[model samples]
Target: MKRFQKAAGQWLPKMAKLRGVTAAVVASVALSGCGVVNHMVYKTTGDVLQGFSRNHTVPYLLNTDDLAMGCAMSEATTPLLMSFGRVTNEPDQIAVMLYLSAAGCADEQAREHELTGLAALGDMDGDAAEDAMIRQKRAHALAAKRYFRSWQHHNAYYGEPGTGECPDFDDDLDEFIYMAGLLSGLQALNAEIQSTSAIGVPKNVGSMVGRATSCLDNEKWWGAPMALRATIWAMIPGAMPEGENAFERLEMSDRQGEQAGVRLSHVFHAISAMNKGDNERLRDVIRRHAESIEETPSNEDWAFVDAMSTQLIVAISDRMWVENNGHRTPLGQLGTFWDDEQEDVETMDLDDLL
Candidate 1:
């Protein structure tokens, strides 16, 4: 009986160890299964978000004419949308638009601050002007950073600009995104210059984007590609091609844009004119934009793009008005200047009627 008891005790301890080993294996599998389930859930969710954003949200935003609403959406949702990058491939195309729109908001704020500084200087309030200038710089710096972020995403998706062959775009939307990316790079450089401090925007971005515009068909894109290249040529010393006149090309591009009802090329023309201190040319460009939008109506498929052009043109007009008149362009007077000649109107003769 003692021998039997000894054998039974040894068997019982072995069984206990065996049970513990089985329990550990089961627990490990359960934990591993949870991890697999989590990865699948996250990946699925990311895919859905990415698909919806690219297919639906982007198209809806592009169709609308409300820049303020678009800007708000960009600012509010960028973080949430971008966070999905942790679980899946980053939605670099959407990132380009989000950052670009957000940058526009910053750029607008910077322009307002610049006007405020100008007004303060006009008042001879040196301290106030300096303060406004500081604020302007900060806003410009923010704009530069956001624009650079967009450029980075652009590079990720389309390959580095000025590098090897252009991307094989899947559709018109892909091509449009490429153009926006180019614009983002150029804007980043401009905003960095305006900030007056090195905001890490590469100086070579101008020349790079200038070359990158060649990848796009200028006519298919409503002349915007050439306008962008021409603007860079005008802005950057020696960037223009041999025998090419930047302003002339800009004028040609302007015609194409006006006819297409996109009118984005006018923004580049105005930028070039403003940069060169050619107020006459700037005014002409703005006036043309005003008349074109009034007569042509924005392209139905790209109304948002047309509206953006108008917004930037009006901002430029406001800057000019504020500089001279200490106020923004008056309502319904975007194309008219304070000093412009008033048109003669036929008046009824009261004495003759009497």
Candidate 2:
């Protein structure tokens, strides 16, 4: 009896401890993985459900705005999509970051293009415009390369937003937004090639930009796609069809944004002026943006994305301001200079510390 009691006493506490630890671990996983599991289940089930509803119910219901959301859901959902992409490496999922990054490349090009344009527009005594134009051309060349990098990814992973039978608004918004950025990238490339023909760069974008239009329903979509079509008509070297004026279309897009109470058209205008290196126009547009927001701050319903964009363009002005005055943008800069804030100290000799 004593021997039996000793064995039970020895094992009972250890068994209880093991049970307690296992329960805690299970609780932690269940709390964290609830979201993960729910997303997988919903996505899997949604795709299965899409098979049945492809012909009738899906198209009419989903077409009001992209993805049938009143506000931008992509801002919130993109992180989740990115995490899933990293784990699965699925083509479509992986394409999300690739496409967005492509947009980022175009954004970068706009900044550099502005700088080159500034150089080009300067009145110099000897070969000033010519020198600046060459640099501008090179700038575009690099922008084109980034655009090409994006295009390669698109060709590999971008699925058409719709099938022959129905529009896939779910995936279409993601794909087409990337396409919008691509069109700008292509136009930037075409311009650079024109400027630097002596370098034997290919000046061919009409076909590529024209071909892109087929995949996107530009008639139904505005903003970036409309800007793209306008660019196609104006810059693609007689690529415009009969009776289509690119400038009119561009103005019409601007008007559309005005009527809609959101001047997304400003971003396009800024990009164009930057390509031309016309600082006056860029500054004017930036001022208009600041004033517009002040006038109707509440109207811009998608606060995060639109605000983030304004911050990016404002950075350009900050860059100029810093160069001329040796100070940063007013109200601090985002992802820019911090050297001023850091304390300057003499480095210790190795012997002093070691």
Candidate 3:
């Protein structure tokens, strides 16, 4: 039987591609006939996926090939990207385990354990449905917000006037900034969702879906940051004068792009379903997002971003699959990332770069 585990945190470009050979091998195994021979292949796939987290605590060294792949745009920007890689990689690995199980590649026992983990985390005293959804969203939001802060530092080129030397500033940093904006918007929405009195299930889920889908249909990528904000406000229910004019500001930004919008739309759809108590919809969103992830032939950088995003989605939504199939676990219900910062006291200095 094949074993599975969950991927935790965000995924960066460096860890996005598992070598073309590795990806090809996984795809081959997945497509092969299911029997004793294929079983062996499945087992190997599980092992390779799980191995990603064996040494998560160490700093990842960028290889010569990685540099050749355009990872080093600037010194300040490079380290931040590396940090993002580590932060995102943790949760991403945990997500991978769930995805494998949901795909029917994991053993029955493992599936059961995965469900138990998700339930434990979100059930809040073994309730029928998850009660900790809001709390869980907050934590995810915080991590994303922190990452966004770092990304902004790196994107100093885009910073407002009078802003001092951005230690991590560079031209290519816009991509990172755009990505961070999506994550931050999600975090804010999560915060708003948690503040609702609607218990485990909420009516605003549908509204959120509508808003997110509206953005997608309109092909408004940059507007997503505000869409999420609007959704969060709507979720608050009858809170007169929705604060922070997210919609107007998001509409004003002229940095729309296909990749960012696609990613945001897919994620919003998944979350909307989960909040609506429609696990089936969530499942479909997951599958659709997974399929839409394409490796572009012209731009290798965009391909890396898409691949990494797909990997993260697979890992994060894998647990939802288990829950829909009657498997409930703490791990399955809440996507979690372990933060080493809480345990360490070392402060990083940025004065030298300035």
Q: Whose lDDT is greatest here? A: 1
lDDT by residue (tens digit), candidate 3, 213-232: 22232333334444444445
Candidate 2 wrongly placed segments (more than 4 Å): 1-93, 102-146, 159-172, 178-181, 184-203, 214-222, 259-262, 273-287, 298-305, 308-354
How many collisions per candidate? 0, 1, 34
lDDT digits (tens) for residues 31-55 of candidate 1: 9999999988998898899889988
Clashing pairs in 1: none
Which of 2 and 3 is ahead in lDDT? 2
Ranking by lDDT: 1, 2, 3
Distance from true location, Cα of 186 in model 2, Å: 2.2
Where model 1 places Cα greater than 4 Å from the true spot, the runs are 10-14, 344-354
lDDT of 2 by residue, 176-276 (tens): 44564455446445545544534332345445555565566543443546766666565456777899875566566654554444555556666656655
lDDT of 3 at 292: 42
lDDT of 3: 0.38
Global Cα RMSD, each model? 2.4, 16.7, 28.1
lDDT of 1 at 327: 88
